[model samples]
Target chain A: MDDVTETDLQAYVDGQLPEARRADVEAYLAARPEETSRLAAYRTQRDALRELHADVLAEPPPARLVHAAEGIRGAMRARLARWGLAAGWIVLGLAVGATAGWQLHAWNSPVARAAPGIARQAAVAHATYTPEVRHPVEVGADQEAHLVAWLSKRLGGSVRAPRLAGFPLVGGRLLPGESGPVAQFMYQNESGRRLTLYVRNEPGSGAETAFRYAREGKIGVFYWIDRSFGYALSGELEREELYAVASQVYRQLNP
Target chain B: MHAAEFVALIPRLRRYARALVGDRASADDLVQDTLERAWARFHLWQRGTDLRAWLFTVMHNVNANRARALRVHSEFDEDAPEAQFRPAENGLLELRDLERALADLPVEQREVLLLVALEDMSYTEAAATLGIPIGTVMSRLSRGRERLRVLMHGPQAAVRLKRVK
Candidate 1:
């Protein structure tokens, strides 16, 4: 009963055995000291290897990878702005040259600049607040009306709570903004993985709207500027899941 | 796959790259190259097939090309083989020591070993990923595991093998 071949034992260790052979393999292992020790060694080796590299998956992918996924959106936006200025100039029947000049100048000015990192900030806020066992959000989802009214009032706009598919509104909190007040909306799945929508009013964000993407570690953020408001959605999920949630938020707000 | 879906695989690719190259800089470069290559040829990737397995196949081919350019060969230390691999009484090898042993494994053995052990791929998946026969994958895994145990047990690990006359 102990004539187990080396490959058969290897298959057993690797979990490649048929159900019928499992008992025979177990019996063979029970009778053999040397083979048992080796199997123990193999399993331990596998565990150690996994432990050493498991952290890699936890950390975020680098910014270059994020930019690659974004597919030249920034470059295209910068180029399209000039043509847009020309079109807006003639369509609105304003001072075409002057408006075009101001638009071009505004593109260079601080009005178009939002300090380059609302996405990272959103990701950080989500990472910090989402894990809270007691106080994840300042105003719970139970106070949905009050939370929206207060946040919108403070930001001087309508800051609505988004209802994403498969993720209910868990709650929300008021976070200190880069300049003024910021509102963070938290949503959670059944598994406890959270998604956060961060919004704050930035006067310098200009009237231009752009969809931007950034990844911080395992977190993926789809952030955009719509007129004076900067909105971002952060989640640990991969692209497709996060995009679905982002689309929901965008539609709810624009509607 | 969508670009974002490709982005999601970056971490897994990076981890495998680090394991394969045994250095951070080279691994990062390898990952970047793999992503670029995958993106360029993403249309070729049929949907519904396992993305992870397909990615591993790409990585294996990329690694093969890189190794061929470097003219690298798997020349493991051959001073002692069967004698050094005999089971020892001690079972308390350090994890760090095991990692070092893993790095010392021959490249071919290490690849199959990691595909099976670290990545937990089935033998069929692993063979397809490496573009090798299932038998070759099994043999390499067997050799790799033995070598890793002996190395972790320390350089002089040995016990008498029983023989019947």
Candidate 2:
């Protein structure tokens, strides 16, 4: 009786001890009132728990969760089809490679060429517009609200003109492009350097693509598409400087 | 298992899952996830091994993962009051209190306890289902039961001990 450990009492409560040992523990509990109380407490807790959760067995599970799981099973067959005879890891590797290849091809395109595209576009826009004192923009920054509404309407989805934090708004204009109507919002720093954000409805069938960087002439353009709407930030600034401005644009636009 | 076969096990899976998670909604999610995983990996289940044990193991692993995610996101902090602890609904010796108390236990202890008390799994079987040692299973169940006993009666020890005259 004095030799019994707390674990032994717990084992007895759990019904894990052999019958003889269990009987011995029971007898020991009978003689020790405190131990008996603990057993009673354990039994009550077990019974209470059973009462609480027993109905969960009868309750209907949510259809949505079950459906999602079913959907996964359905997709498994199709996934295996595209995987060919490759092992899971090999297939995963191939998938990663394919994604990288597609990304490289897309990123290197004119809309997303390395270093030249955006820079060239930015330089073109800056050079063409900055010298114009009377016609810097088709629409001035004074009509900011109307500019956003008009641009958003033309873009076929809601578009917010990005507010560049480190720079002040110069003016915005509507320009004809190979893509649909493009809205260009220009911002200037205290140093008189200009940045242009070009947004339009993606050309042709429209592509849902991620961020791509390109250099157009002396300008650098960082472009991305969300749904059918396309966004491009073009500037003659250095890569990091251009990116810093673009980051501000992205935050404001996304927010 | 095929789609039909997987669907058929849904009820039994839910029962075992409710017993494991101690929450109806989460248990249902766990069972659904389990069946999906099972269907995808059915071929990997060695033909000679116990299907019930294998299913239980998969469900156990999935629940463990969900528990880890819950810890990380802690998204349901608003429901934390009800998540790990909720009082029994009415006056009875039903399983609700047990379920709530079960939720309060750590993942390992709760799994062993449920496998033993509700699933009627032997220590060896529970161990195999958990991929743990039999001794570990014994220790967990022992500790879990002791903790459950304390939580169950700590508040109502006096009323529970009173006999009807």
Candidate 3:
């Protein structure tokens, strides 16, 4: 028989001993009344401890704890959803890349020549507006016609908000550009992520219509100059997502 | 694991905390702090492992840090007034004696004993939860149980014998 050590006795009392070792400990205890009484006392102690806190197990947890748990679960689900959206964007980028080789070709061209100053201004406007909670734009999307008319009058050209899928127009605000007033139109998704479209009158600037990308810190700008006005889309989004949105803006404005 | 599943373990956590801290308000506060820390670092917890053990480990660290901070602020008194036995209104006198005895055990030994005895954790789980070796856990358990027995019965019997003598 294995030696009935103190550790084994403690384990035996806690009901953690192996079945084979249990018989050995029991046989060892049967002959020793002193050990038997000690083991009984240990058993009684365990029972008393359990009985002392038994009421706690039956009580319902507090409301604050339940709410905190629910909040965590909600945040986790939001993270997973964001990941899913990113995966979908990757797949869409591949499909867009297949047909949009012209855009990829333009990607290699000198983006500095396209209009670096406009890209910087657009990124600045994005950074300023995206963090606003109460008033993201000067005029809300509820007055879309009035907002379009007002911005068009300020920028000296008729500007239209692009109807990007999944990004609803939040509104527009006018800001001072290097040479003139610029119209900044904002859009927001369901998750509250904001994207801004900056339009400034570039009457004398060369009409280079190729879509170009520039990054200012974390903000990505996809800017292009059409006939009379320069349009730049800025957002804190993946390059592909910004590119996709910029493409929609170009198609809608040119069409 | 899902947050609801984590919430489901609260009763067990509360029971263990109550036994460890010996008070309702402080035990619930400990559990609340544990939940907050656990959620903030939820990504660190690997899936498919024992979540209960992970939580207990977090609670052990939280409690230890609090105890350390508390000791720094106040004198370490074994017989502090708060540690005095408050008999439950309807609880038996013997159980009240047991509570006092349990409270009187050294914190290390008491934690190990409660994990093994009240929480019904295996020696391995208690060791893992407390971040101590299994051998240390065994020694603490042996010492704790023996100390508890003496505290519960020895003093009274010895005083009676001394009076008769």
Candidate 4:
């Protein structure tokens, strides 16, 4: 056996040495009386130290320790509750922000959301036909009741040919709109200046709107939206003239 | 870890605590502090490691912090090892001398020596628990074992031996 170092001998007492080293330590201890006595003394120290306080392990743990352990679980549960509440608030905040975004976008974008296509068609149709010499009216004022009835049936809402104090009904025609067909009714006065009112339903999902005006070159247009349908008046005239005509359209449609 | 696991660790903690502080009540206080700390920092403990060693390390640290904060190193205080001297029910003189010698060890040596000699922890485990190097554990163990031997049987121990013999 190699000379057993103190560490190896201690390892034997600690039961930490591998078997080969431990056997060597055992043989080494068997031969040396002085080292053997030292080993025995160390063993006694270990035993008395253990015997001195070994009973402590069998004693029941104090109540404070038990309560402290329970406190850990309770604190974790409270933290989880706090985290759950925080997550709930985050979700609610996202929902509110989304709804607010929708409401703001709804309230602020009427000019952008207005049925520009319908109004443009009105302007284009007026521009297309105001210069024509004939065929300006497809079904003339003689078929006015039939015109209103057929147009209303197609548009899914009332199509009123608005009254202008100077301009009487010239004629009415059906034009294609974004969702379905549109109705354009023409009126003319002594100087032959004409105005067209375009009406359609099923344009877009929107709430009520107010009278807003736009101009396509010299042609003035006044447009507004209600719960279900949209109306636009197009004519080469003063803004006041078209406003008056659109107000008349609005009042009659609502009435 | 479950409550049962923590419960299982309690006795060992108390034993180590009593070994370090050498008093039952103070040792229980140390165990309570260790448990409270372990509960708070349980997540920081990695699984698949020695939980007992981890708990011992926590108790060692808690005891150290309390000692430093209170500046109270009740090194062999009167009530502790002296209490073991009341002529044992069988008057085991040798055992009484051994207990007194153990309590007389320096705090650092007792911490390392008891962890190894009594708790039967490996040197590496004792080193890790006391946040010292393994070589340091060995040196402290050697010094502590030698001090305990001299105190138990040196010329100064003649009186104890005569009483026992």
Which prediction has the highest TM-score against the true structure? 1
Model 4 lDDT, residue A190, Cα: 96
In model 2, the runs with Cα more than 4 Å from the true position are: A1-16, A59-255, B1-8, B69-99, B155-165
Candidates in descending lDDT order: 3, 1, 4, 2
Which model, 2 or 4, shows the larger lDDT? 4
How close to the true structure is residue B54 of candidate 1, measured as C-alpha lDDT?
83
Shift in Å, residue A17, candidate 3: 0.9
Instruction: Please state the CAPRI-style docking class of candidate 2.
Output: incorrect
Give the per-residue lDDT of model 2 (tens digit) for B19-109: 7665667777788778766655655677567777888888877777877877752243211222232334443444545556667776777
- Cα lDDT of model 4 by residue, B107-137, tens digit: 8888888889777898888988888988778
Give candidate 1's whole-model lDDT.
Answer: 0.74
Off by over 4 Å in 1: A68-255, B75-91, B155-165
Candidate 4 chain A, poorest ten consecutive residues by summed lDDT: A70-79
**Model 2 Cα displacement at B155 (Å)?**
7.6
In TM-score terms, candidate 2 sits at 0.46
Residue range A1-255, candidate 3, lDDT tens digits: 446778778878988888878888889888987778777878988888889878888888997666454344333444456556655555676676644555434443433243357888899889988899998999999999999999988887788988988999999999998889999999999998889999999888544444556899999998767778988999989987887788788778867
Q: Candidate 3 vs. truth: CA RMSD?
A: 19.6
iRMSD per prediction, in order:
8.5, 14.0, 14.6, 20.3
Model 4: how far is A220 from its true place, Å? Answer: 76
Model 3 chain A poorest ten-residue lDDT run: A106-115
Task: Please report the candidate that would top lDDT against the real structure.
Answer: 3
**lDDT of each candidate versus the true structure:** 0.74, 0.63, 0.76, 0.71
* TM-score (chain B only), all candidates: 0.80, 0.73, 0.79, 0.78
